[model samples]
Target: MPVFADVDTGVDDAMALVYLLASSDANLVGIASTGGNVDVDQVCRNNLGLLELCGATAIPVSRGADQPLSAAMRTAEDTHGPAGLGYAELPLHQRELTGYDSAEAWVRAAHAMPGELIGLVTGPLTNLALAVRDEPNLPSLLRRLVIMGGSFDYRGNTTPVSEWNISVDPEAAAEVFDAWGRAADAKVIQQHQLPIVCGLNLTENIMLTPTLLSRLAAASGATTTAMSVLDSRGTRSTADNTLIRTLEDAMRFYFEFHFDQGEGFLAHLHDPLAAAVALDPSLVQTRAATVDVELTGTLTRGMTIADWSHRWGRESNAHVGVGVDPAAFFDRFIERVGPFARRLQADR
Candidate 1:
């Protein structure tokens, strides 16, 4: 079983958690919330509520940094809504309080594990930066870190040059990259690879297809009904109707913000693709290259510069995902979620 540590602050991040729960392969050890799309407190609250909705109350939830290390804090409230949950008005569910401080807790958990654990990050790398600094051996303890941030050649959602996660805290991201580079230098990890980066270039290749939508709808109905019955709740709020509701809301916001100004009906699942990559690397096309984060370029602060030229003679420090097989990815996604869908129906 693999333990996953996620630092999330977006509605899509919540949907990613639901996907992880539905997948039997991911042994979710804990979740750490950070302030990116919303305040730190709200992110923590949303994490608990989402875990409860998915019936994953046993999983520990922790709170992380409230702001960036050195940069002015910024958020995507317009895209994720005021609460970072698509503006869906629903009462917060009561749950047990988190037991540890987020940053320190993450460091402790990583060290306590027998071996390196899978790290999944969907927000700014602030918490990770702090963890590496606090625990000198933290980077070595990570089996792998799959980050859903940055853009290689595609258009960015934040600015013309930067992605939201990286833009939120470029300084922190820089530190993380540097730390990982040092760890890779110390040991020759498997496959002669550095950090595996699932940037926008690959995630954009995965779009919401009609078939995928239909499967999601079916699963949504069954899960909603099962949850309602199990909880003894007579009625399900329209806002809390199904897990797909969160996905739908995220797609709506993403499309409006990026492609159609809110008129488009669907958007690609960027974060989910990152999660899928963590589960199986063969699903994507990866190339090892020396990658650097631009922290001073006025128009490209958060941009990841991959030295593909090989002209500069820089050693490759990261594995950059360049492409993906969309058809195969869709098949795997549906295949994994199908069992969960069937289980939901059978339970009903």
Candidate 2:
């Protein structure tokens, strides 16, 4: 299956990229960059650098939306670190970026693949919204859209009522959700499967535990069986010696953020979980809902209002992720990418 990723190149985004590269099923066609974690330029660079680090540079990279459709840009530098990769730094990409911008990349890739492209979007919906505006028939073209945004069950991460990705560009999210829910022409009502949303409600459950980290932090030189967790492991200090140190460095800030949130040395692996669910829909248990974004509200602006009841008489446009198998997801990630993990103590 052809998989397309739209990312902000945050720490978790990098993890998703690597996971996709390592996956046996991922025929990754291209990656489109958008502004959220840092900016579109840095997102492109980060995407390229990760592809290079994973030895998957053959994948094309496209730079997209420097800002939201109609809102001022906000970045997660504090959460993702200054460079967006946390502590790890990657070699500057030698290959030139793809000519198509983010919007163009989404449109072109979808058209080329027709109804076979499975998209995982892990950032603000700026690029997607722009693509929809350019190609009104975009919703009907994609095989599936799995978005890592919104917060329906609990409090939001950014605001009292909004999650970071959706809060950053609610208008764009609104357009994307509405597009999938209803066709471009009002007379033509399409019953599209609601985009699967791995929102805060579902993502908060996939926390990074010490055991998971220890398994992933094993030296690439270590001999192991398939999906085997090394009986003996290196200390946290020596974890930087692993090839996946780049991800380790990035998680420093994430760990700290989680600590501040009273989560205790654990960071919710949000984007990667979205990517996992996208590639394998069975990874998450979902409930269909008529989902929409709040573009104008005094306190609930950017909030994703999901009507679970049939009172709205609206078609369900989003499959709200309600449950996930954390262990299965983590195991799959390690099994696919662990072989490529090596020792690298470099922070920069």
Candidate 3:
């Protein structure tokens, strides 16, 4: 399927992008950058840089919101590091930023592919909100929308009641839910809405362990090309090993963060699972809900209010994640993703 990605390009976001690019199922048409993990400009660089590394620079990329729709931008530098890739590094590139407005890029991609386009959003919903504002029929245009935010049945990561992506831009999130018939003013979903939400509640199930990292390392030995994203001239590093090395460098910080969280040297992959669910909704169990972003509560702002029980007598607008098989999810990921990484690594 043609996939349009909106990303903040943090570590998890990078993981998601790499997974999508490596997957045989996803035809990543474009990426719209947003400010969350880092600044919007930096996120653009990260997106392009990753493409350059994978030798997939042909994909279109553009800058999106530099700030949220309303709230002040709050980046996760402490979590993803100053560059949003932790300690991982990529060579600078002169890749052109294609669109003047990210909303245009988003809507254009949908229009080009129409019902075949699958949207994967792993950041604040600023670009999507802008696109929906431009085209109210956007929900009907997309085949499905998979988002990596919220904590419906679990606690928050940003604050007592917020996930980083939603907390950073509750207004935009609210707009998205409203458009999809998940907010207070939302109407009932018609016939063509497929919105699946993969929140921390479900993503926290599959944590990245050393075992998975070892498998990833083994798959990182794919071929490479002379053209490096770091520079026009290819650097002297072992071409076959660059991919694995890059992941390792970035994940060092991620592991430490999880260790401190008492998770024992492991990181919960929050975004990639959403990408996976975008391709196959059956990967996780869910409940129908009318979800709204909490914007007024001093202690609960940015939280996703998913009425799993139809508490408000509203039509369900989203498939809110409730459960997933951890071992099965990881097994499927490694089995499918491992071979693809090996193929991408061989690009050079």
Candidate 4:
């Protein structure tokens, strides 16, 4: 089985968490939240609420960094709403807060596990960076690091060149990439231990299909009901309605808030696709490359530079996902999430 370490602060991040909770292949050790879409405190609360919603309250939730490594912290409230979860009012589930620091919890979890554990990062890399700095052996303890960040060839949703997660913490991202490079170069890490980046290029292929949304609507419990009511009241739009309309009208404006300059009926399910790739690598097309984070450029602060030129001819440290079989991936995702949806809906 695979143990998980999550760093999240997005609405979609909650969906990804729920998916992991439902998946049989994943054993959630602990969760660490970083400041991205909201404040660190809110992200922690959201993480706890998500676990309760998924009936995984036994899992521990910890708060992470409130700001980025260097630059001023930014948030995506315009897209994810004020409270995250699209302002949907979920019923409160009382949970006894854990006493462990989020980063410390991660280290402890790694130590407790018999072997390497997977680090599935769905948000900014701040917490992971802190963990690496605190515990130098953390990377070696990890079986793999599947990160949802960056953009290779596609235009970014945050900026013309920057993806949200990387844009939020470029300094931390640089550190993580460098560490992965060092470990891979030394051959101290297994082939699967290298970081697998599920960037916007691959995630853009996985759309929230109508059938899947219908399944989610049917699967979600009181949370879905509350969301539907909120959608009706115009507080937010349901994923089903937003996705269907985007596909139908070709406007594609459900999640795009930074740049309103796209013509195709496509929105990247960036975080969920990352989780899917972590669950099964066969869903994507991968190529090994020396992926670097651009931190000092005037216009490319968070751009992910995949060294595909083969000039230096260095051993590839990163597995960059270039493409995905959207049909096959979505089918598998629906198949896996479908039962959980039904069970959750029934529980409600």
Candidate 5:
């Protein structure tokens, strides 16, 4: 699969990038850095650094909008740490971003690939919305689109009804969904399909526990030190494999954050699960709906509403994810990434 990802590179976003690199079938052509987990500048740095760390620096990284479309920018530094990688630190290699900005990058990638690109967005929809505005044909150009955002009949991580990515830029998300609705209604291309939306209702089930991390380290042939809640906060992994160590350090902070939130010591592998679904949509089962974002509700702003019953009387714009097998997802993750980490250690 030829993949182009737009992301605000936080801990789970980093895991998604690494997962793409590790997948044998994934050909990651480009990455667009957007603002959500942190500033777009920091997101770009994290993308470059992770690429360098994974020995996949040839993929182009592009800078996106500095803020959201119609709201003040908000960042989740507390959730993802100040630099957006939790306790993990990666050196940003001396690499230049793509000559064009992120929106242009999106247009160029889709044009160049021409029905061969799988588009994945795991951040605010600013870049994609801008690209849609500039190139109205973008929806038909991609082979498929998978988004890691929104909450379908589920409690939001950001608010009672709003998810983080949509809440960050409700206007952009609204535009994106509206554009897709128009495209679906138009039926411009014979191969056009509605975007697969991996909402929190399904993604929150893809949890990352300490036992899984230990299994991942063992698979990498690293000396595994199992993480425990009993350990002091900020305890870092001592895994010999560099990749395992980096991910463990990153996930530990995520675990503690979730624990403090009363969600137990498990981290939701949100973005990575989206990445996986991009490659294999059968990993999840989705329901078609007319998806739209709430922009002006006092208590429901940024909420993604799915008109599953066609009350809105519009074409279905999204295939909302409602079911998944977390165990199968974890099995796939460990199988692919563990050996990739071992190979990285060997190359070093």
Candidate 6:
């Protein structure tokens, strides 16, 4: 129930963090702000601001490296907005970050709660890779690890054959996968539960629509205003619930971005679905695979390769998500977050 989150604080990352906070079973122990959707400094700011918004300011947020392990850091401002919260504006909080760095945070959390921590990473693998390097036994320390990255047997969202997170730090991603494989080969893992990888292939299916957003608002017992594709691009939510209003504003930008990309007027709740899977792996059906990252391919760098047939002759490092029920996930999301938002509104 102790959840350790590493996030880039993108609009979807904010959703994931809020989902964890909303879940009754999740005790978010710490947050590691990594560089991806925005800079590390901005990520820390977003994390602090988000905690303040949810009135959960006690969570310790740590900062990670500003750049990737091997490549020049690239941010997705066009996708996540300039400040990484989309169109929503959270109040700037004066909360300071944790004393130690993110890698140390990971090690300390795992040590403090040995075999009881659930690790969820919704950004590039830079911080987690550094943590694994610092503590070689990190793979066995967590009860479960869920990563939101990569695409297996599916088209990529970054380059022609690369996903955003992995493409930003292919070397770090490769190192993390290799570390898990090494741990498995050494037979050090007790549960043999490989990291559940929520790749783009499966996550893209968890789309968010205006109707669902309205349903969430109504579930929160708020005065809801329905969002529509015919509305203005910068249309804001008129929900009575503050949390729902913020989410609606953020998701409006996301919806427009996806529509511009010809996807539709819907946004994929990629990181939130990953966060859900971390708490309940039964939400998704996974296949064991020796997952690796392509680092030097001419046109496929950062491509995630899943050896589902033992072609690599190595131990499986990841349980690649093969199938899921998007409706079930949405139901859980609304059921959990709606009441949480209602409570926050009542407190206000």
For every model shown, the clashing-pair count is 1, 5, 10, 1, 0, 0
lDDT of 3 by residue, 87-123 (tens): 7898777799994778999899989988889999999
The Cα error of candidate 1 at residue 312, in Å, is 5.5
Q: What are the models' TM-scores?
A: 0.85, 0.90, 0.91, 0.86, 0.99, 0.99
lDDT string for model 5 (272-309, tens) is: 99999999999999998999998889999989999999
Cα lDDT computed for each candidate against the true fold? 0.70, 0.81, 0.81, 0.71, 0.93, 0.93
The lowest-lDDT stretch of 10 consecutive residues in candidate 1 is 225-234
Judged by lDDT against the true structure, how good is candidate 5? 0.93
Is candidate 3 or 5 superior in lDDT?
5
Q: Each candidate: RMSD to true structure?
A: 5.4, 4.7, 5.4, 4.7, 0.9, 0.9
Alpha-carbon RMSD, candidate 2: 4.7
- Residues 1-348, candidate 1: write the lDDT tens digits: 465655565666775676677778888888888888887788888888877656677888888877899888887787777777764433357776576767776787777673557778888888888887888677667677788888887777688878888889988888887777666666644433356788888887787643465566564443322121122212222323344444554444554444335424445677777777776777778888767788888888888778887665755667888889887876666666655545543543
Model 6 agreement with the true structure over 270-323: per-residue lDDT tens digits: 999999999999999999889999999999999999998898798888999999
Q: Which stretches of candidate 3 lie over 4 Å from their true place?
A: 182-192, 220-240
How many clashes does the backbone of model 2 have?
5
At residue 132, give the lDDT of candidate 6: 95
- What is the TM-score of candidate 4? 0.86
Show where candidate 1 strays beyond 4 Å. 87-91, 188-193, 209-211, 219-241, 253-259, 310-314, 338-348
Worst 10 residues of 4 by lDDT: 243-252
* Total clashes in model 6, counting residue pairs 3 or more apart in sequence or in different chains: 0
What's the distance in Å from true for residue 260, model 4? Answer: 6.6
Error of 1 at 102 (Å): 2.5
Cα error, candidate 2, residue 293 (Å): 0.7
